[model samples]
Target: MWHLAKAPDLADMEVMAHEMFALLPEGFRKLCEGLIIRVDDFPTDEVLEELQAETEFDLLGLFQGVGLPFQSGEVSGQMPNMIWLYRRPILDYWAEHDETLGHIVRHVLVHEIGHHFGLSDDDMEAIEAQVTDEAAEMPLGAPARSG
Candidate 1:
């Protein structure tokens, strides 16, 4: 199969991320209005330094911008919330793991979205569970990647 020949690139991963986000519950999606999703092959040098990552693969995804609970009307020049998906790290993870790429993408998206809401780990787990249950009802398919 052509899939065996190459890994999905940044654009391909972006499509997968957006599709997965669309599959999330409407309430959650509404809460995330104006959120942006972007995919890159690796994190920037600045990000690596900031996160103190030992390796580029140390992070699979990241959430940037202020969380809802921390926002203040007095604050100015705030940026929109964003979720970043790293394609190379995610692909490397997929190579080592048994789960489908769709599942991995969905999990990362949910985790990052949780950050936007400033949800605790337990709450995040509960949200993830809801996604898993919902996904079981209708499986999501990963988009095909083009070289």
Candidate 2:
């Protein structure tokens, strides 16, 4: 018999995102060296408007800033790339799906970053396969009680 803990909060989800990033293939991770990962309960009104989201749950993750392929020596002081994971939306997704929370987080992370890098569908699929396998062996830690 196994005991499962409560659902993760924003902080816990952030940690999961970091772990998932670290577990990606070295070459893929190298491309995202300075990438930032963040978690929020919901996208801000500003962000939602910018992305043309129909609802708060519509966006699970987002990639911001210039992608590597678009970088040029002519441009300077560009903002570092960042990935945002929406916790409430993700949790809602988890509740409705048959997959683990870790799997969902990893999927969102890879999909956002992969697109930013202009990776092909096959490339993303390979990364997804690896992440799913690794996440299965990893424990979904007991999240702290949200205040």
Candidate 3:
């Protein structure tokens, strides 16, 4: 089992996020080099307002950034890719479902990042099969299970 460091005022969700990131294959990691992963207790008022979320826990994860395939040679400056993991909803999911925490984090992480790359479910599943110990044992990380 993977373990995260313990620190004061630290949200375990962040640790889970990091662990999930580490579990991704190196090939996938190389594809999302500048992607930012963040974890918060819940979506802020501003974020909620923008997403038009009906509740704080409505969203589990989000991807906000320019997809690489969309960029062209003329591109000079562009925004970075980012993935946000919602802690409250994640915790709620773990509590309500039969899945494990690690699995949940990986699922959310993969869905948000993998979807951005336009990867298909079959592709993700194939990759997951190649790295079963990392993907299957941890569970989640697929588009449908993301968050």
lDDT of 2 by residue, 22-107 (tens): 77777788888789999999999999999899999999999998888987764677787899999999999999999877788888
lDDT of 1: 0.78
Q: Please, what are the lDDT tens digits per residue for candidate 1 over residues 6-111? A: 6667776787788778767777778787899999988899999999999999889999987778777756677888999999999999999988787888889888
Greater-lDDT candidate between 2 and 3: 2
Give lDDT per model, in order.
0.78, 0.82, 0.71
Q: Could you tell me the TM-score of candidate 3?
A: 0.74
The digit string of per-residue lDDT tens for model 3 on 1-147 reads: 237633212255676576667667778878888788888778889989998999998889998887768756555677678899888787778779987667777778887877778988877766555444444344233332222
Candidate 1 regions exceeding 4 Å error are 2-5, 74-76, 132-147
Runs with alpha carbons beyond 4 Å of true place in candidate 2: 1-4, 132-137, 140-147
Better of 1 and 2 by lDDT: 2
Order of quality (lDDT): 2, 1, 3
- The 10 consecutive residues of candidate 1 with the worst lDDT sum are 138-147
User: Candidate 1, TM-score vs. the true structure?
Assistant: 0.82
What TM-scores do the predictions have?
Answer: 0.82, 0.86, 0.74
